[model samples]
Target: MKTIAINGSPRKGWNTHILVEEALKGAASKGSDTELVNLYDLNFKGCISCFECKRRGGKSFGRCAAGDDLKPVLDRIHTCDALIIGSPIYISEVTAAVRALFERLTFQYITYSKDRKTFFTRRVPTALIYTMNISEPAIESMGYAEKFKFYEDRFNQIIGPAKTLVSTETWQTTDYSKYEMTMFDGEARKKRREEIFPQDKRKAFELGAGLV
Candidate 1:
């Protein structure tokens, strides 16, 4: 089975990367072939809103028309059995790179039938991992959690139910001297790392192992 993980964090080895790596490790333990793509390392542009992909009688139907880094990645996403995406929240939404990837990838799958209605028909099982500095309560208060739900529903409607993994109230601004105090929530994070996350990771691994 094949699984593809997309790391959307600009920081290569930071929180988002750690979570994706752990999930991938679990997947590998189940004897699934896994690959990771770091978006910041690739050269890609945001979707240009060109109607070329949806043009009638066009050869690029069901594919992105723009020639950019997203083309190859989209190819993998289309064929991969399981997809894992990790991103650090910027403001109340995902990072720009991830958002751009979504825009470009989603456009490729947009289609219409004889009725002239648009819809997404291609199905891909997916998981979304988002880490942020805001606490869960704060996220709800700020309406970010609801925004996440919007994305979740959209993904489920377009691709499939995307298992959501969120790490909130993370330590982003760290100082060496008062590190212990700053990591007051370290124990909780550790528990999640050692327990909750591993379970999901194993599940993801099994999902990959069972894929065709």
Candidate 2:
């Protein structure tokens, strides 16, 4: 078995990265070859509407054709068993990297012809992890969860339903005192980091193993 994780967070060791790493560990423990991809390290763009993937029986049919650093990744994805994508919410939506990756990954595989078939005939277990500055209660209040769920449903429609990991009210910096950020209660955020984050990692590990 092979499982790969892509993290769209710019920070190397931040919340989203940590969660994805945890999940990868789980997949590895289950005897799967696991890899962690940091999207920031890659240079790529979203689908350019080339429609090359729409060409019937062509080399690009039912696959991404964007030629860049992400192409090799897509090639691997075509044969991989499990996929995990995680990102920090930027203004209530996925980061540019994750959004671009999604556009390329999903649009290419989506066949618009009659029957609306997806490229993947077999269900590929997947995971979606999110890191945000908001709290759990505020997520539904802001309707952000629905937006995330829409993409989850999109993933399911293409491949399969994804297990999700959410880290909320994240600590943005090592020292909150350095910045002029009075909106958040530092103590509560620290409490979450100390108490809840460990459990979240454990959950991520379990999610990964289950996917395998």
Candidate with maximal TM-score? 2
Question: For residues 90-171, what per-residue lDDT tens digits would candidate 2 score against the true structure?
Answer: 9889999999999998888888779887776778889999989998899889998789889889998997777677888887
The C-alpha stretches of model 2 lying farther than 4 A from their native spots are none
The alpha-carbon deviation from the true structure for residue 61 of candidate 2, after best TM-score superposition, in angstroms, is: 1.5
Tens digit of per-residue lDDT, candidate 1, span 146-176: 8888877777866776777777756453343
Q: How does candidate 1 fare on TM-score? A: 0.80
- Model 2 clash pairs are none
TM-score of each: 0.80, 0.96
Top lDDT hit: 2
In terms of lDDT, the poorest run of 10 residues in model 1 is 203-212
